[model samples]
Target: MDIRWITAFLDFEPAAHERATAFWSAVTGYAVSEPRGEHAEFATLIPPNGDAYLRVQRQEEGPSRIHLDLHVDDVRRHADRAISLGATELVACDYVTLRSPGGLEFCFVTHPGESAPPMTQWDGGLASAASQLCIDVPASRWDAERDFWGGVLGVPIEYAGGSYAQTPPSADRPMHLVLQRLDDDPPTVGAHLDFETNARDDEAARHQELGATVLDTGPEWTVLRDPAGLPYCICGPDCR
Candidate 1:
């Protein structure tokens, strides 16, 4: 798949904003961008090529349903930095997963090593530290959603479980695009994975071809409901 962007939909109460921003800033060595309106968001650049960015949004509702797979040359170094920045080192924080200051979760593995970085300053916006975002899907919809992402993103199913599905990154990296199945009625529209394609037409193409249903579409972006009726989108940084 020609996947270009990945996002982590976080469920954060408004009160955690200051601490979350400060924690993220220290981890990235860049300031966190302030929210511009009703929706909460923060971003930071990764410097040099600017091929990608990472972000976190405040979901004042409940549990986040999705997570991101971050690719780093050294998971240890990133984890250490995150700890120094006030991010708790959760159990199993090493090797595979880690949670941020605001309880935003992600996994890191050393596959598909990164190239040398260029010198640059953080622009206080999300950078592409992650290669793929994983959306949680319902068990009944596992195969359906797997097929949807496989066909829409031009990738193959990496793994499937009774309540989980794993997709591979489109970039030249080894990152798992994960999905978790829900058993009961959804309490809230929690977390969601987002993509940044080259254009809106491309997003529409996926919707048309794959069975990805449209939730909303604007001039700058488009929202879609996956097979599980989870929310997802494709938009530029400005839309964040």
Candidate 2:
């Protein structure tokens, strides 16, 4: 399937919607576009350049989590193809909503001309982009889920070791996919955003000042909980 563009939706419960939106806007240095969608539950984070690909949604229930919205020339066609592969369709039509065999949620929508935006530059020569979507699948479901996404993405999923398999990043693709196998099988699958930053220490500090709680830090990445209670990571000083 030819996925022309990809958008990451950061969904939060009603109580934390506003705060989460603000935090993400500052984190990516993107302006929060005016709210749209029925009941005013949707908005896009408009960047300084390029069509917006990050969005925010106010949820009535469910924990704050990230979901991918894939843009393509033929929504229904590609969507059906995904369903034919291991994805189970949750909603049907020109725009489709479905869950992967491993249970991660995603959508197919009509494509427009959108190019990936340049990384936002912060003070002190720090640069960052919320560029990768790390899909956390339980160890038992990794094989099926990896195969499904790899087919849908029309790319090879190469194991990068340490329980990680990734589709090589392409300039034409807006979001890169990384499949991670969890040691403990949780009740459900989840995804998180990873910011590739040149100055990891400084970037972590900036995010903390914006109300993110640092949960854990390691040599490779530092995990933090956003204001809305969703965990994300400041992953590198150029390390993937």
Q: How does each model score on TM-score?
A: 0.39, 0.96
lDDT of 2 by residue, 28-67 (tens): 9999999998889999999898778889999989778889
- Please list the C-alpha lDDT of all candidates, in the order they appear: 0.48, 0.87
Clashes of each: 13, 0
Candidate 1 lDDT (Cα, 0 to 1): 0.48
Q: What is the lDDT of residue 136 in candidate 1?
A: 53
Quick one: best TM-score, which candidate?
Answer: 2
Which segments of model 1 are wrong by more than 4 Å? 9-11, 27-30, 34-42, 45-50, 59-132, 160-164, 172-176, 180-240
Error of 2 at 116 (Å): 1.6
lDDT of 1 by residue, 127-163 (tens): 3222335565554555655564454344677655455
